[model samples]
Every structure is written in C-alpha cells, then in structure tokens.
Target: MSPWVADIEAAVDSVLQAYHRPGLPGVSVGVLAQGEVRLRKGYGLADIAGRRPNAPDVPMRIASLSKQFLVTVVLMLEAEGALSIDDDVHRYLPDLPDYGTPVTLRDLMSNQSGVRDFLELRLLCGGNFSDPATADESYALVKSASRLNFRPGTAFAYSNSGFMLLTLIVERLEGRSLESVLQSRLLSPLGMTQTHLARSDIPWLAQRAVPYVVENGCAARGEWSIPLDGAGGMISSIDDLLKWARYVADPASPHAAHFRRMARARPYADGTDSPYGLGFTVMPYRGLDSFGHHGQLPGVFAEIAWFPQIDAALVLLANTTEINPFHLGRRLADALFPAALAPRFPPEVVPPGHYYDPGENRVLRVLRQPDGENYLDSAMTRAPVEWHQAGRFRPYWPMLHLQLAAQDDALVGHDGPRAVAYRRLPTGYAGAPERFTGTFYLPGLESLWRISLHDGQLTLALTGRFGTRHFHLTPLTDEVLIATPAQAPDGHYRPTLRITGAHGQRRLMITTDRTSRLVAGEMLPSTDR
Candidate 1:
C-alpha cells in the first residue's frame, strides 16, 4: 500500500470495523483517482453459512445506481440525434395518457416527472416485489395509474416508474436487450468487465456475493425482490463502479456535456432548485460540491460518490441491508485530503442544554456526545446540528427551524415569523376510534383492509401481495388513527392513517404519506369478506 492511500484505507477500515461482526454479511469498497483504482478492499463474510469470504471484485446488486446507466443511454441517444430529452414521453409510449400537460423525458431523467415510484406503486396495488412480474407487467401496472402524484416539471419526486419507462424506451430504440445496449455503449468502452445489468439469463455470475440480511446478530436471506430493470437493477463490483464513477466525473469525455449536466441542479416551475439532476444527487459534503447516488434494496447496499473537484470517485458495495456506505465515501475523501476539509467544520460548538417547544408539545434536548459534540434530540430522533449560520440551525425536517441566541434567558423556537413557545408537559390524545369499523376495498389493491371494532378495541386486518398482517390503531383525532404493527416480518413502513369523506361519499384514505400511495377506497359490506 502507498502512503497516499494509507489514510483512506484507515478511514475505510474504521467504517468496515463498525459494521463487521460475526455472522454478519460483508462489504466491499473501491476508491478511484484519475481513472485508476487507488484502493479496493472487502470485509466480513459474504456467505456466513457457506463459509465464503467477500472480495472487492464481487458484484452485488447496485439498485438505484442503475438509473445512471439509463440516464447515460438517454443522453447518448440524444447526442446521436435519435431523440431529445424535451420530447414528450407520450411520443414514445403513445398510448400513455396525456394528463393535461406533456411529461418530457428531461422531467423523467431529473425526477421532476412526478411519477409514483414503481415499487411503491406495486405495493399500492397490493403487488409484491418477490412475485415474478415481467417488465411488461410492471409497465402495465404503472400505465394503469389514474393520476400522477403531481404534474411533471412542477415538482420533484423520486420515482422508479420514470426509469423503467426509459429502459423500455432504450430497448425500443436500439431493438436489442438493455444488457446489450449497456455493454456496447458504456461498460465495454470503460473496460468494466465485472459489471452487468441484472439479468435472469446470467443467474450464476462469477465472484458474485450472495445477498443476506442480519436479524438478531445472525445472517438470513430476506424476502425482498426488485425488478432488475432501470430503477433498481444492475449488479456491479467496486472496480467496475470505480471505473464508472471516474468516467462520470470526467466532463471532457464521452457524452461530456451531458455528463456535466448530470452533476448540475435544475429547478422546478416554482423556481426551487432541485438537489437531484439526471441520476446523481448534487449536494455539498463538508462544503465541497459532490455528486453521488445511494442505492438500497433488501440484502443489498451500495453508494457511489464522485468528487469532481478532487478528481476522485468512491464506491462502496455490500451484501447486507444493514450498513450505510454513503458517509464512508466522504470520510475517505476527508482522510485523503485533510487540508482541503479541515476548514469546513466550526471552530467551536454550543454546549449541551435543553430547548423547548411547548405549543406543539415537544421538548428539544441538546445532548452531548461521547466526543463532547452536541446533537439535537426531539424525543423520536437525534441528529447532529448543522449550523447554517451563527446561532441558527436547520432542523432535519425542513418544516421546523431552531434558533438560539446567548444574550437572553431562553432560546426561542420559531416556526416562520411566529415565536412558538415550548414547555415540558405530558401530552395525550383520545378521539372517536370506534367510528372506523367495516371493510374498505381498494380497487387497485383488489383487497379489503378490514378495520374491525372488536369490543371497543380497534384493530386492522389486511392482506398484502405476499402475506397477511395485523395492526392496532391508536386514535389521535376523530379522523386520524395510528396503526401500530402487532407482529413483524413485514418490511412495510406505514405509520399513520386518516379517515375522511363525510360530505359526498363515505371513503377511506391513507392520510399519512407512506412510501407507497394507495388510492382511496370505497367501503364495502361487512359480509364482503
């Protein structure tokens, strides 16, 4: 190992050590500088039961990182004059309903198309990822969507449907498989021998790591699957990722101008700049402009980040769902270029103390870390405070703001212009919980999520694409109910529910924003079971 790489190696080792435990799935990391692999290493057990060790060269599912390849192909086709990003999607998929306005390819590429995420859409339709649904089936499911979450170009929403459509478009234009197009256009050109778009034909990939999930300190296979299409597809090794990320960082290379655009931010009709462009997220890490993509799927985790200013790229791939490699890349960057990163941190930070917001019934706990750093705790989540300016802190949730001044007796919490006061008080809520009893049917899901009023206790019994689950609702308001799960194995993350529709029709809707958007359903007879 060279002296230049030792620091990065140590930094990566620290991250690996944090995640590496006995019977845990493993990780692989690759660092690239100037088109060469500077460092590559793997840790933990790739297959704990099989006694196989993970290596940096092993390809794992890259998930959403595959979107970059779709974006690249689209840009390539555009450069070839075959199509334009501004072309309406309906032009390609003519049967696609034109909902008031045109949805352009650019909107899809930049995630301003407002397409409901395909995975979320599947669950919304009571479809399971583990089910063997073809790409055409997936397309039909997306096509059947009655309305987009929002109009294209007006808002930015992360979507998998847009990319799936793009992959289909790519295959349609080239009249060949997606794998073939990717190979001839990008992978072969970059000498990325270990990378491939996830394909069923190549089931037994060489040096491939078996995906695993950890539960109770033991490795186990997870019951999760995603279509190996444009959205959450592609299996790649760190070496291949390094080559690809390095390629993306170079604006003077193939599809150079488009590559530059991929790293830049575009705005919506509202003029709010979107942090995402093409397939990569454009953000500041330690005050340095960075372009990267984070991918997570059941039993698979990966992060690919390119620091264009430093002319370096970092790739982290893992076989487990538990680890997050996103910040490890930043750590490596900081370690390699300490002098470049030191100025980003504040010289001094505030001490641990309590800040209160009694109106909303929450207290802000500023707690000290083991390292003496202070963090903001809001009962539910603890987060490191990012100082946007002196005495001002941005809340992890965009809706809230915390500002403190050393001058006066109390630190004030502000919600916009209003001076919202905080106090320490025990809060409780009781509402009309029994009103929500009877079978509600979602046509999209084709299943009834029956809420039964069993002896004054409210319970929800529902069937998913894969299995059945139960929940008990805690009433928050007359129209709001919190559905807490009884038992687990469900990867679903629905937390809240709201009941409405008194005026026109008695309808049931999910008021809480979940990953999946289930259409409001009509109430069916109790005998409909």
Candidate 2:
C-alpha cells in the first residue's frame, strides 16, 4: 500500500476505534478508490450472543440504501421500452387516487411526488416498526390517502410511499416478483452473490449481522416485522457493496449513461434544481461534487457516498443505531483526501431568535449552545451549523445547505433549492392551545385525534389499530404547535400541527420531515367525544 492508502486505513481505525472492541454490535466499512478496494473491514461483533465478530461478508439490512438499486431497475426497464420516467405514474397504477395533477415517475425518483411517507403514516396510526404487517397492509395504508402533501412536482418532500408505488408498477410491468426482477437484472449481472432483497417474515441468513438498539448502556436486539418492499429491504455485505460501487464508478460500464442520469439533479416546478436526483442525493462536500444516499431503520444506519473528483466511493453499514454513518464517512473522507477539502470559516453570528416562515407556517430557532456553538433547531432535529462564509452555512446533515441574509427585517435565504424567508417573532409569543381543543377526524386515513387541555398543558391523542398514543403539544406560535409523543417509539418521531382558519372553521395540518399537509377537520360535537 502507498503512504496515502496507509494513512486512510489508520484514519478508519481512529474513527471506528470505539466500536472495535468485542461484545458490541458494530459496523462494516468499505472504501473503493480508482476502481479498487482500498479497505474492507468490519469492526466489533456481528452476533454478540454467538460471539461472532463482524466480517466484510456479513450480510446486514441496508434499509433505504436499497433505493439506488430500485432506481436502476426502473431505468433498465425504461431502456427496454417498458416505462418512461416522464410518464404519469397513474399509467402503470391507475387504481391510485388522483391528486388532480400528474405525478410522474421522475417526481417519485426525485422525492417531489408529495406523497405521504407510509412509514410515518404507520407511526401516526400507533403502529411501531416491530408490528407485524403484510405487503397488502402497507399498500392499503398508502392507497388510503385521499390527498397528496402538495401539488405534484411543486416542492420536495421525501416519501417512501412513492417508492412503494414504484415497486408495484415495476412488478406489474415485469409480471414477476421484485426480488426475482432485481436478482435477474442487477445483482446477478454484477456478481453480487451475497446481496438480495430481504423478506421481513423469513428466516435471516446465518451469516447476517443482528441489529441492536442500545438503551441506557444495554444493547437489545431490534425487531422489524414490516414486509420488505422496493422502498427499503435489501441485505448485503461490504464486499458486495464494493463490487457494486466499482461498477457505478466505472465510466465505461454498460449502465454508465443511466448512472450519470441518476446523478443529475431534477428541477422542481419553479425550475430551481433539487438536491436529490433519481434515488440519489446530489450535493457538494468539501468542494467535491458527490452523490449518494443514507438509510435508517429500526436499528440500522447506512450511508453510501461517491465523490467523482477523487474517483472514490465509501460505504458504511452499521448493525447498531449508536453510530452515525455520515459523520464517520466524513472523517474517513478527510483522512483519505485532506488536501482536497476546502477550508471553512466561522459563520457571521445572527441574533438568536425564533424565525418563522409564513409560507410553510414553520419556525426555525437559532440557538446558542453553552459551549458557544450555534445550532439550527426544528421540530424533529437539531443540527449544528458550520458556516462556509458570512451568511452561508451548512449544517452537519446531508443534502442541506442554507444562506440567511437580513432583508427588509427578515432572514431571507434558500434551504437547498427552496427559497425561504423568515421573520423574527416577538419574544414570548405563545399560541392559545385551548382554541384547538376538540376531536378531529381525518377522512383520508379514517383516523381520529383528540386535542385536550389538562392542567394548563395540551395533549394530542391519536387512537388507531394498535392503541392510543398521546403526544405533548408545545406551542410554537399562535397557530402552530409541535406534537411530541409522550413515549416516542424510536425517540425521534415528532410532527408539527398547524392550525388554520377562523375560530369555528379551524383545521389541522400535520407535517413531519418526510410527510406534509395531512389535514384533519374538526368533527361535530357528538357522543364519541
């Protein structure tokens, strides 16, 4: 190995050293450079009970990283004159509820379909990931939606429901199971012998790594019973991923054109380019153009990034949720190409306050940590801000960058491809939570929710198939409240409830990171209350 290659391996060790010990579930990392496997190593244990150390060939659930493969299959079918990315999705799945606009395959690929994410819907229905669900149940959950989050192609919102629908379309067109189609078209062709679409109800491979969730320093096995589909359900090892990466990075590969097409950004309705392309996130990291996607499930966290400037690809697959693959991937990239990284300067400090976006009825809080670090706070996440210049900043998350400049007493900027303007709210602005107290019905999912006030605190209760779940509602403004589950199943599922209209005609709009505009109308006073 050359000096640089040695340095990279050492960097990987340093980054993953904490998980290198025994008796803990860990990760498998693969690094490919110039069409060669520079490093393929596994750290920690794959099966703590069996004392099996993780290896490069230990199959693990990759979650949404399966999307790239699904997109590839769609492209292959398109090449065969079976479908077109620009064609309306209803052409293939005509039974789908019409949203009064054409939702094309391109919209689904770029996450602009405005479809509600089925996973979030399941959570909203009081169903956890561990709950047993069949493919039909999953499909029914998505198909029951009466409206789209927004007009198709107008904005971007990540939706697994779109991909699930794509899976149906692919199956309908090919007249075969998605597993069989993927195996015959992509996995088999690339010699990815150990990679295949996993089924939730079947027995796991003996060599597969056991997924674990660490709570209070204790590790427990994670369980998932939702059926596998094209949205996310692939299992593979580092070796197999490396082989796939080599093929993707090869300019002379037969699917080179398709890969390039997938990497190109697709524009929203306003003609502004989106950060996501076909099943891939297109962004620049350290001044290097990159494309990749991250995946997360109950206990799995995975990231696959490809930097064309350095002709390198990095894949990190973890069986435990304790580690963030993006952070590790950034550290590994820094070690491999330190000289290639662009220098970053501290961002110009803005007055810490709550900035509200009127269009989306959302608020962004600029908060200062005790350590003097600044963070951008939202309902579902708190990401540290790393400023690139005076007004431009990039958060410590993928596919997100922003520039906030003061304009007409407002913070005007763009969040990725979406233009946004936020006005600082008056300090101590609190909404009247009592005004929203009542039972509401969502006809889309046939779900009912009750907003109640008890001891000066508001709670939103949702009753569904599993049971009832109560979420603590914290007022953000006179019209918006952040509903946080009293005991979040995954500890990260929160949605914002925005109240609109006048006193007697008020409606609720629920939104999450991956879902938006789930409207619920107030039900008439009845005995059900």
Candidate 3:
C-alpha cells in the first residue's frame, strides 16, 4: 500500500502502452525496490497470428542478459570455496588451445580475455551459428582462433566466445551445464519457476512471445541463427525477472553481496580500467551508481537496470530487435522517479547558434575551439541519400521496431542483378568543411580508428585488431556537431561521436553507441604509445 507502488505501476503501464505497438508480438516488464517487486506485467500477443496472448508467466528468450546470471553462479561457487576468479582457464579446460597467454576467469567475465568473438569471425567466414546443427560447432571455431588478440586483462572487448568458455568452465567444474547450475543454486531457491534456458525444441513454450524482424521494410521473423546459446540463451517472464531483481537487490541473499567484489572496477593488464563488472556493465545514471545488463539476439531486446544504493530497478523486454528497450526503460524509470530525471525537451527550438546542413552541402565551422577540444568521426562511409532506397535495417528498423536481421557486408542494392558499391562523404560545421586528422584508440577494443579531413569535410576510418570501420561527422561549432551514418545502409552499425580534448590525448565520447563500446576514444600521447 506504499504510495511509491502506485507510481511504479503507472510508470510501467505508460511505458508498455507507449511502446507496445500492434506489430510487436509481445513484451515483458519487471520493477522492483529494496528486495520487493513492485510490478510484473506483460502486454500484447505472444503468438500474434496464432492468437496466443502474452502472459506474465510465459517464458521467452532472455539473450545476452543471461550473462549476469552466469556471473552470479561463478561468484556463488567462489563464495562456496569451489573456484577462484583468478584461476586460469587452462586449469579446467586444458583442451582449449594453448594460446601462450593464460586467460583467467576474471579475464573472461570482464571481456578482456582477448579471445576473438566466435560469432563475428564465423559470419565473416560465411558461417551461420544459429542453425541448430551449426550451433554446437561455434565453440570449436572460437577455440581454434590460434591466438589471443591481446594479453589478458590489457583491454576490454566483449567476447561471446569468452562467456561460452565460462559456461564450459562451469560445466567442467560443477559437472553440469550453466543452466543446471542456475536452476539449482539460484532460481530454485528464489522460486523462479517460469525461467528456462532455451533449447532448439521448446514446443511447450508455444505461449512464448514470437520475435519479429523487418524485411524489405515489412515485419518478419528474426533469424534463429545465433550460435551462443548458454551465454545469451535463457527465457523468462516478467514475474521471473521480478524475482531476479529482488534477488539482486537483497543484500542478505547469498549471491547479492558477492557482486560487490565483481562490481568494483578493476585495472586491466594493459593499464586501462574497466567499468564492466562480471557480466554487468557498471555505469553512472542520473548521478547514482547503477548495475545492469542488456541483451540482443534474433527476436529479443531487453534491459535490466538497478540502482543498488536505492534498491530500485526496472526491466523491459521486447520480442522485436527493432525496439529501443533502453529508451522505453528510461521513460518508465523517469515516470516512477521523476526526481531523478530531466524535464522533456520542448519543440525544435534549436539551441542558440546551432547550425543545420542539407544534403547538398558539406562544410563546417567550429565557432569556439577550447584548449581541450578533441575531434572524432564515426561514419566514414556515406549512406545513399534516398532513405527509401537505402537498406531496410539501417536507421529505422532497429530503432523503432526491434527487428533483427543479418547485416550482410557484401550486400549491394541491385535493381536487376548488379552490385551497387556505395560510399559516404564528410561535411563540416553548418555544412562548412573543416578538415581534421588524428589517430583514435578504442580502449575496449585495443585498436586504432584513424580520421582524415579534406576541404573542411571529413572521412573517419577505423582499422583495429578486429577489422575496419567507417563513420561520418559534421561540425557545428569549432567543437560541436551531429554524427550519424552517412547513409542508412545495411552492413554498417553507425555510432555518433562527439570529440573533446587538446592537441593530443584527446577524448572522444560516443553520445550513442548502443553496445557501450567506443564510448571514449583517447589518443595516447606519443610518449605513452
């Protein structure tokens, strides 16, 4: 009967109703405070065509968010004197290739193990990991990568391959799968009966939400082709996620306090620090410390955020890959706790002296260049101007609908059967071309992204330990500009970057990089590098 409970309920309802469009098959939400679940809700139909309503108890794919649960299990074992995070992977999984560098459990959890991501490399090699038969082979493909990309703990890069290795470690040490460990140690005790690790065959899960995709600008089903199952392969309803939130918030819970050690940011072996905790991304939200994880797979978009200090958490799950769960969750959080959120921005009252650019222009002028002003460009390639002609999954699909599909690198728009090679050009402030040149370092990636400018317009290119990337930037002031993909074409995941710094060792903050990588690109001083 607490007054805050009513606010939480209304907030949840508002978020679901606003984002739960007809095309979206289903969604689940959970809100908790101080070990008490305030609300657990579901909306829309699970199997829309089949007329199966999405129920609060219907289990659905949870995806990468499952990493947190797996982390909890590892911590629990650590607590029970079963294993140590510092233990090297070779100690248990000796069958893994001897890559010279020893990868430890903490290295894997922090995503600093330097193991190449299996899914990325596989896709680059004409392989599909989601096919039921090929899923099993993903592990071996990743294990055979011959060498670690970097020394353990030197940098932070998300590696599904590493988490898969963690899952294997659990199986080897506990004599059971990660799913079994969760069921026995955490879920069973917490009474989360509705959650389950997804298998290829779950006929009884007929009531589960149907994931959707966007194809040729229409709604379709997301491809069930991902290879990492255990790392991102669980399904749960809002009721079950609520139970999870409570368990996480409960300080007295066996697994709760253990997170403190995992939560503390650690220095990587290469002298950089990681804001990521075991399976959880540690971030500062609204001036308070928060812990949570986001999941992405074929048909699911999920975010679970909790303020450990206040004991309040919000979770949002969508059955489509196109939906922005973070935006939806933030809305609900703001409504539930208005004191913690900023007021809504009014109409297009542009901030004084803001510049605007049209398709034809490519010039930029930086009005003010502070001593610490740094510059960075993300969209190095240009997207076709005609939005409709561009790839369907570019900007709109994942932004508005939560639809997931393959981003084919070789895909070229063809009217009949010919390839259309596309490229993007850079423009400067207010379309004024201001050229910039610098070397950028993405710490999490332990790679370099180079930028070159010509005639006031700029083209940003990335070449790293993994591969190459392209981005575009338009300057507004001597220091400000809006950054997005030059074109909304397929195959490229464009990120917006705002640069700030002096002549060297500049810092580039990615205003919007969904995966949270490339947040800040720092140019290490020549003396340091």
Reference-based lDDT, each prediction: 0.66, 0.80, 0.59
Q: Write the per-residue lDDT of candidate 2 for residues 282-304, one digit (tens) a residue.
A: 87777778888888877788899
- Per-residue error (Å), model 2, residue 426: 6.3
Backbone collision count in every prediction? 3, 0, 46
Candidate 2 off by > 4 Å = 1-6, 350-355, 365-373, 388-390, 399-411, 423-435, 500-504, 527-529
Greater TM-score among 1 and 2 belongs to 2
Q: What is the lDDT of residue 7 in candidate 3?
A: 66
Question: lDDT for model 1, on a 0 to 1 scale?
Answer: 0.66
Per-residue lDDT of 1-529 in model 1, one digit per residue for the tens? 3224446678667657766666677788887877778789888777777777778777778888888888988998998999999999988988775566888898988887866666655654445556566666667667766566667765555777888889888989999989899999998989999887874424666467877777767777754545568776788888788777777776677677887888887676766566678887775666667777878776777888877766777888888866545645566666676555435435245545544442333345566689875666543234555554456554332212344433243445453323555432223455566677766766654556778887778988776453456777766555555565666423434444556766224566552221224445656464475
- Give candidate 3 misplaced runs (Cα > 4 Å): 1-6, 129-132, 201-204, 215-217, 270-273, 341-529
Q: What TM-score would each prediction reach against the true structure?
A: 0.81, 0.92, 0.65
lDDT winner between candidates 1 and 2: 2
- Best prediction by TM-score: 2
Per-residue lDDT over 383-479 for candidate 3, one digit per residue giving the tens place of the 0 to 100 score: 1111222232221111111111112222123211112322222243354444345666655334565666766567666554434545575555554
Alpha-carbon runs more than 4 Å astray in model 1 = 1-6, 200-202, 342-428, 443-447, 453-457, 463-474, 484-492, 501-504, 511-529
Q: Name the 10 consecutive residues with the lowest summed lDDT in model 2.
A: 394-403
